[model samples]
Target: MTTIPVTDLLGSLRSGNSTAPRLTWYGPDSERVELSGRVLDNWVAKTSNLLQDELDAEPGMRLRLALPAHWKALVWALAGWQVGLETVLDGGPADFLATDDPAGAVEQHDAVIAVALPALAMRWTGELPAGCFDYAADVRSHGDVFMPHSDPDPSACAVRTQEGRIIRHRELISGFALPHTEGARLHIPADKGLESALANALGAWQQDGSVVLTHPDVALTGKLLADERIHGS
Candidate 1:
């Protein structure tokens, strides 16, 4: 019997032992977009290549940027960790509203940063400033392979603020833990209007070593079952 920690997911990704399914991205217009696994793989590959190519000079650092509700945003963020780069998500558009222009926004931050602007904003800011990388194009390049400079610490992540970026240096998810063993089955108890019970059960299951799977809507048991795709039985 083997118990696996939540952190193992990151390791499995780095070792090429696993890949994540497409995370659905919901946009502001009530539109949903699904990015393919191949796109994620390529972005990760490109990021790895870029990290190796730039290590002697830039040595990638934590990222800071605002992203639209696009699936590519997830790819970019994950790609950062894939190459041992830290990533900070934008607080929100209100923070961006403070700036008079993109250049001003770029100058306000101390470190090299990449931003994903709204379609209108991207058109307004014709080209990226020198030394700044276009986050989207860089992640999309197909030929590059990401060779990490160091093993990514699962705890390494960042948060954005109007003032600047703060490194959390810890895994971001809170409130629940997911644990697993190779050949056992487990269930996330129906919410039953008991959030605490679900949390406690999840914690105990994680503690006792059980694979956990969940979905956004607890009513849809069929969807939840389909998504669990792993459980190596």
Candidate 2:
């Protein structure tokens, strides 16, 4: 398998099917959020800009995601990769942390981002800890396009798993363990956890495919499967 750079994969997503929905989320309370390729790229760009501009993130640094397997978490993972930050999924020391619990995360890291998981959240509902950035509030103010200060080193670590496994940037695509389904719409259950969901989503996107990610509480009904044109779980 050919190794596709994370940067190139993101570019392909933006240019290949700019208007089609690449990631579709089905959450509790009948919530459905769909992000077209262009929109998804814009979100990622804004997030990458935020990480670079606001957080002063650099390549080879670590950004730990204390978030669940939600759409926003997926976006954060992609953005972290775009910024060349080693995305840490484990509870290890990191330069920055993105979490739903701002107060708790602030205690662990100096630079913390409070991420709201709700689809329509404009900002964190409550008061954030001192110095903790509000993801929903701050992300929109960033630029829609991102220009990284430096290219990621392919040999540098890209992801650190909870099980203490490391995956390098060059190995991210080629080393993806999921079964590839070309141009297929895959259904990913959120119950499998963040790392699995991220891997599955990456695998789907790499093949010019799409994903229908469902929250744990959301049932995968027959109508949803048919409506989403899901090829596999």
Best by TM-score: 2
Quantify all predictions' global Cα lDDT against the true fold: 0.39, 0.89
lDDT per residue as tens, model 2, 76-131: 99999988889998889999999997775677775999999999999999898888
The per-residue C-alpha lDDT of model 1 at residue 186 equals 45
**How big is the positional error of residue 208 in model 1, measured in Å on the Cα after superposition?**
20
TM-score of each: 0.46, 0.96
Worst 10 residues of 1 by lDDT: 92-101
Candidate 1: list runs displaced more than 4 Å.
1-21, 26-32, 51-60, 89-101, 108-125, 142-144, 153-233
Q: lDDT per residue, candidate 1, 1-233, as tens digits?
A: 12123223333433442343333332343333433344445655665554445423122354543543233443444455455454444443321111113454645443233545342333224665555555444434435454444555544443333345443434332423333343233443322212222233334333332323222243434554566542332
Native-to-model Cα distance after best TM-score fit, residue 171 in candidate 2, in Å: 0.7
| Clashes per candidate (backbone, < 3 Å) | 5, 0
Residue 231 in candidate 1, Cα distance off native in Å: 21
In TM-score terms, candidate 2 sits at: 0.96
